[model samples]
Target: MSELHHYLELNDPVAMVWRKGNSQDPFTDRNDLLPVINGIITLLEIPSSQHKVHIDGMVEINQELYNQTSALLPEQFLVNYANGSIQFHPQHEGATFSCKYKGKGLILYPASRIYAMVRRHPDVVKTLQEIIDEAHTKLNDTHLAMDQVEQAIREAHDASAKASMAADWASQAAANATDAAHNASHAVDSTKLLFKPAVSDMKELLRTHLNPQVGWTVQTYKDGIRYRYDGKDWVPIDIFGKNIQLVNEHTDGLMSSSEHSKLKSIPLETKERVIVFCLPSYLFQGVQNIVARFPFKGEIVGIKAICGVPGDTDSEIIIEKSMNMKDWHNIMSRPVQLDAFSHYDDGQAVVDRATVYAGDCFRLHVVKQGLNIQNVTVEMIIKI
Candidate 1:
């Protein structure tokens, strides 16, 4: 039994052990420690930008100050999972903020007692050895079978290559035959005597004096309309008779489902609302508030910030909106970056945050102005 225990320990996947067993029972006497561990930590800081600070290993956070601890509300702060940092909303700056949270760690797995029990039984060890020997013999036979299959695959691949070459030759022959037939169909008969006259030459000959075939066509220069002879009379041709069915702008067209879908995708509504903000003689980087009231209820489609003259340095501006002159929120996902060469920055309107009701009072915040940038214009487009 002692020799079997030594063999099991020596043949183990890893030989090193961090924490050995504290138990007296032989089955639970030995246990190798795993690397998995977890713990909690506390951090304190005063933030300046957006009133946010970084906390390491903080899976969760609870504010602790002056012998009082309370869980921070999700709305009061925003968690940045990518960098493991927390950004608190407006205010909460210049104050001591402490966060207590558990650190991230690998999942804990208890030591295996089954391996110890198996190592103790000699009969089980003998059965396992027999099974392992059988598996080794079967593995050798599988290797031999795999070699045979590889040889067969190589022969089959060679045959498939020959077949592919044959198929290509057949396809080329068929294409050549089709081209010959197309050329034959389009070839004009030189045996038939026909007169080729221009519109000016045909104008001298009257309709009664002209000899026309059933499928003969003539174009008039006066109205630019084509006339086709129908054996009895010459009739004006309707080019779009089979293709278009015009009723109204929305319900027009005799088209397929896919064609109708494509037509609906085209934006026909040309009505656009533009709100312009002008920065007159502004040289410093600061926020500009433009107070305005929405006249009609509509959805915001897009926003464009245009500058007449781009400054020497790159400029960036953030647009925010506030209802009732308080509680401002960013309308733009990110700050619009401007440069000397480019004077315009376009942004797509976020549907949920951009909707405005009629008679709603709102203001635009054009913050973070660049150096020496003047005559700045911000355009907000609304879709009715």
Candidate 2:
């Protein structure tokens, strides 16, 4: 009747519509008014004391159950429908506070006063009339719409308009077909974009073979993605993040590895391939751990890595493969940090990301003959 409560001010009491005896409603039980009551309670800021504020000698007229929510009571605030209330840490209320419902020396707060104050406003009275008119109009329109829908459905069942109905459906289908065609055109454009690289490659191949030297030069670079061979190894150098400067690219790669082979008692540069062991059976079951140092002992291929530190350094790492559970204590007890490693398969140095287990064919396995190797531990430095 009163515009159905479009808005409520913070201080406006809710009892005007919710509290038992505080409001006049033909329906809505007092016990079922918790939400409306709590909504108002959520407002109204009242100061609190540190210790709990408890009120007794009260009575609850409503039939709602409070036992279920008592355990979930917040730390600093408390609410009692009537009989009693316990506010823990009363002094530290939240940004918003609660008000007194009924207690000794406490003025009673109800909503009858609120409803009267608001309903008396001239603008509110006008709005209420508008709301009543809108409701009636909407109800009439709803009935008319339902009748129209029913008549339309009945006509659809009639055979007299078969041609008209067919035409309507055909028009809709034509629109859909047009949209699908448009979408297919876009898809073709996307397909062209997807194959642009392949087309360019083929064109270049044709041009190179047909003309033989129109826009081509022959050169070879280092065996790494980062380096483009132009007779010598030139690493990608982007200066000012714009132009690429061709410089020497240093890399560490595995040459070869074997579980049975030793370090060969030689310097790393002397061998093109690295002699390392496979991963531990316990850490990665059924797999081999093989790695090589920088300046590989054999031909470099794919991606490669080397020991990061200068070969002239005085550090001695203990390299171990096929680690047993009992040897874990020995590895952790070491004072030095471990080094990075790489993967080796068969006799070649390659990068294998697809391998998840040690037994993979792509995996070239190696291991120190014993549980550990002194003066040499292996870690990997992968460069894509």
How would you encode candidate 1's per-residue C-alpha lDDT over 1-384 as one tens digit per residue?
111112233333222212211233211111121121121111221122232332211122334431263334322444443233454433434333444222221112223222222455354433444556678999999999999999999999999999899899999999999999877754532122232242522354244337776556665543344566666775666332343454444563444556677777998766777666665554334345466677787877766777777766666766666565556667666666666556776453343467877765545554544545667776667776
Model 1 TM-score is 0.28
Off by over 4 Å in 1: 1-270, 346-352
Candidate 2: minimum summed lDDT over ten consecutive residues — where? 26-35
Residues 1-384, model 2: lDDT tens digits? 211232356554432222222234222211111122322233122112221232221212222334445433332234443323333332333323323332121123433332222354354433444565678999999999999999988887776677678899989999999999999976654333111111122334344444332122322222222211122322232122222343322322232233113444444543222333333222211122343333311221232223322222122223222222222211112212222232211122333231122211122222212122122324333221
Against the true structure, what is each candidate's TM-score? 0.28, 0.18
Best candidate per TM-score, number? 1
Query: When superposed on Cα atoms, how far off is each prediction in RMSD?
Result: 21.7, 25.2
